[model samples]
Target chain A: MSGNFIVGQYIPGTSPLHKLDPRTKLIMVFAYTIGLFFLPTWLPVLLAGIPLGIAVYASRLPWRYLLLGLRPLWILLVITFLLHLLGGSSTAPPAPEDVWATLGPWTITGTGAATGFTTVLRLAWLFSAASLLTLTTSPMMVTHGLERLLGPLKRWRFPAHELAMMTSIALRFIPTLQEEMDKIIKAQAARGSSWRYGSWTRRAQALVALMVPLLLSALRRADDLAVAMEARGYQGGEGRTAHHPLQMTRIDRWLLIITALAGITIILWRWA
Target chain B: MNGMLTLRDVHFAYADGTPALQGVSLDIPRGGKTAIVGANGAGKSTLFLTLNGTLRPSQGEIKLDGRLMTYGRRDLEQWRRQVGLVFQDPDVQLFSASVEQDISFGPLNMGLTEDEVRRRVEEALIATGTEPLRNRPVHALSYGQKKRVSIAGVYAMQPDVMVLDEPLAWLDPAGQQEILALLAQLHRAGTTLVMAVHQMDVVADWADMVIVLQAGQVIYQGAPQGVLAQQERLLSVGLTPPWPVQVFHDLRLAGLPLEGEPPLTRAALTEQIVRAWPKK
Candidate 1:
């Protein structure tokens, strides 16, 4: 199985960002997201975009991967932009005599346009920051970071172990599922199931036919996983110890402090 | 002497009323390599499952080390640990996130100490020659490697007898030889082996005993030579003799002097053919 293809696919490199501890990357990502949300003006948006762009470049990942990650949310971006353009009239008019032109002869106005542009910029910043984090850090590292961050919660009866297990499994199988999908598609194609000449509903039904086998195979894989886990002596997440320990280095600490300061600065500027 | 494994008049049908196995009876002595040969849908896999207590027979009893096994859930769990079953599909057998964890699964379920489990994991990896693949993800290994890992997973449990279902299926010639050699080595080391296979060559050359299943019934069970000698009986069930046996039969038809039955291995066949040839 081509097990390396999935969302959050880490590009292995020797970049400084890649060397940072996973905990640092996790905290930085959270800080960067919060800062993006609080940025009130285009100035902050442009400035925030700088670190994200540098991070992406330094990680040496293809730019198209970042764009691909946003493909699913493209419709949402467009919807928000259109809504902001139409909803501006409820607040204030830009001009009285030229109101119709400013509002685009219907409901779109100057305020709506501004809001739409800001919303798009904010969405871009959030996605870019997230993509950078994923590209820079391996999934195992991310899971390790999560385990560390959630370690204290274990005292409160929280399922830190189970949650970490789920994360690792998701990381492990997402690529497997994709590879299965590709194989199923190839099999269907071999059987003369073509999507090219089908009606809209027919195409949808064909997709359903394709998905049934994939889902059934996934269920079988899950059963095998349960059996394998049981055979290995995994007894419900108790008394298991990790082989690799998580340690935070000096670069990790510095990165965490810088990201935290950036977050505070964004919040203060927004409130002021 | 008590047999290590015994099945008496075992009958099984699927939920949909498909009769998979009917009145199957066999006794597997400890520390011998036994091969079960049959066509697809001939109940070989069903028989393997019965050994491990995965599928209980409708009628008949399965006993391991003279102890009869019941179909109850508690008993089934205990019986399963005593018999390791390596499934035909490596993909199904290996579902762990990592190879080491997969191998340690059975030992852990048996409640071995952590250190013991680790030691067994290391030993199993070495036994299967997959020690370097310990850290590799289960899904990342090749099909042959995955098969070895699956075998290692079962081996780690330290079962007295190992049941393999079509161990050579989908493997290349080199892989087949490697696995066949490994099975022979295990048998020599006194690990009982019960393998289901379709390859007559392997059954003739490697198995100490051959059991032929046709339409879910064992028609013949004995040494490989006696089974091969029943040409018409084997032909009735859509089975052919091994290549050497077929060649021997042809040589006999050509009026060659032969003292006894033809051999199964290449070296034996060549030696017999040279001996039969007229002195020049």
Candidate 2:
């Protein structure tokens, strides 16, 4: 239930990155991620890390939060690095030509270790850049940007408003659901339902007992919310206006221009 | 005056063929505070659900203001709007993200404008004394605070009659006093109140009328004093009289000349004790 667990977790600050329009941030994140994919060498990857470092600094979010966001991908990073290191040079022993160093009892080669380090560094840059985008944008604002960016699909009867509303509800309920899960866990602990020292089947049974109540409560909440929505005169997406409109300011334009230039420069410097 | 609610020959059973309410009939007068006292599983909650049209009886009619409430979509919605029900668990009643949003839910459903909804939210929060908790998260509140928020959520709807199920359960002494005072205030404001309570002292001091339910039937219905005097009937229905009534009974057993009627309030009990003191 900690609020930090949510995606698009905005740290409240008066920094310029926080003030940029959500649309600009969303576009910049997409462009930056694609630009990272095309960097083929360690020099470009390290160069790309500079803008990401600036974004992290400008957002005023603590470095620890960005690292926490990468916790889920740590195992994948390890696997990729190990695979590159072990497979980068798969051949018969080179006739003492490729071996770079020899000690009294061991030999050091050139190919594998460098490739592994470069791959790990590139992956780290990719994750940190993605995390920076979420740390600076609120979920609602991100959804608003999505609605605006998807506005052209309205001519094809895509139901942009409904989609946006659905996204907003999903975003709003993530923390609520996590809070409920925590309460359920505590309630089960009070009941002496042991999640430790149990066989797989017993643990599964205990989990079912805990999950049933939470699911029932969630369903009841959903029913109540539907009734509440109807009572509040929330008819389907029609004739409703937002309380806070998403407006682009001068800072947003500057941020967008800077991000676009960075992305174009990275691509040109690498491939052009 | 016609009663606010009238049930005649109402019969209900669960889908598993267990009879919850059988031949239950009662009348609750308008502008009167009524307490429905019963032991657990004695059909008090089932009866409240019936009143709000959530459960329709198998063989009876419910009349509100002389109009029969049929089990239909539109009629049920109207009935629900007229009789706001506060559930036993505050968690179930309050599902909104914020207290203000939860309180404004019922008013908003009634098709009030944004300004009207805001006004009612403010008024309900002030009425329940939960104005300061307007922006707090619902799950972060304590049990007693959540109970008050639930009541405020119902109050925002401005129902003619408020039906509360076990309103005082799980509350400490101060919480109980606050809820009792809130009920009294609501009653004074001309809102008909029907509550299911287990505490006999609350019934003695606050209820104008008392209904005792045993095995899903109306076993007793009269003024609070009258009901408290019927010790045999109360005991049969698994209910005990208030403490003052017990003291009055003990005095009667001690050969004191009792007054015309039993006392139902602290002041009345004290005055009766003073008057019944033997001449020295």
Candidate DockQ values, in order, are 0.26, 0.22
- Consecutive 10-residue window with the lowest summed lDDT within model 2 chain A: A236-245
User: Which runs in model 1 stand beyond 4 Å of their true positions?
Assistant: A1-7, A13-103, A106-114, A140-184, A187-191, A198-209, A219-272, B57-59, B67-82, B97-127, B131-140, B156-158, B185-190, B217-221, B253-259, B270-280
Name the DockQ score for candidate 2: 0.22
lDDT of each: 0.79, 0.78
Expressed as tens digits, the lDDT of each residue in A174-249 for candidate 2 is 6667788788888888888755548988888888887888889778777765544443334555434332357889
Total clashes, candidate 2?
4
Angstrom error of the Cα, residue A76, model 1: value is 5.3
TM-score of each: 0.78, 0.75
lDDT by residue (tens digit), candidate 1, A163-211:
8877877767866788888888888889877555578887887798888
Show model 2 residue runs off by greater than 4 Å: A1-58, A89-193, A198-272, B70-77
**Local error of candidate 1 at B80, Å?**
4.7
| Ten contiguous residues with the weakest lDDT in model 1 chain A | A96-105
